[model samples]
Target: MIILGLIAGALTTGCWLPQLFKSWRTRSTKDFSWLYLAVFGTGILLWMIYGAIKGDLAITVTNSLTLTLTLAVVGLKFWLDVLKPRVRARAEPPAGGPSQRSVLPVDARAVADGTGDPARAEM
Candidate 1:
């Protein structure tokens, strides 16, 4: 039973590697919705808690490791999809320099609409 649990835990916990690698390589998570990551992470966390309460070593260890892996992807998504863009948007343009393209997609749109300062919208 212990061996079986270990084998099963290893397989299940390792299954997230491909997706995590792809996300890290691409530095993009546009295909993933914020809702999906949140809900799935929440479920994994609950499973970890359940395993802890049940005193199941394999379950607890596997879910804890899986949660860590899941959070890496979540952090990448948050950083690349959310925080980085906001930071870029807030960035000021170079002084006395030609206007450059906006790095943030939203700011680029604002530029198209002529609502944002072209200089500040610079990448």
Candidate 2:
């Protein structure tokens, strides 16, 4: 049972790295939803609390690690999307307006248009 528990924890926690790396490489959070992160982080906190009450080592350990990673992602999102822009603007309000974001979001409409589907056809 302990081995099974460890495997379960490993699978869940292991998935966090790729996500973290992707975000780090991109350096933009335009594709991530603030609301989703908030709700997910809150759920992880609740899971930790529940694990403590139940004396479940697996839950406690897994959620503790997950919470740490989750919070890091949230913090990164806040730093990149909110705080950094304001600091940049104040520090060097460009002669023109603020420069464009480092990354532009993928537009669904453009993808659909390219697909040549009748639904995407212009009226």
- List, residue by residue over 42-91, the lDDT tens digit for candidate 1: 99899889989999888888889989998998899989999999998778
Worst 10 residues of 2 by lDDT: 98-107
List where candidate 2 sits over 4 angstroms from the true fold: 94-123
What CA RMSD would candidate 1 show? 11.2
lDDT per residue for candidate 2 within 4-65, as digits (tens), equals 87689878987887898898899986777989888988998999899889988888899899
- What overall lDDT, based on C-alpha atoms, would model 1 receive against the true structure? 0.85
lDDT comparing candidate 2 with the true structure: 0.81
Clashing pairs in 1: none
* TM-scores, one per candidate: 0.71, 0.72
- What are the lDDT figures for the candidates, one per model? 0.85, 0.81
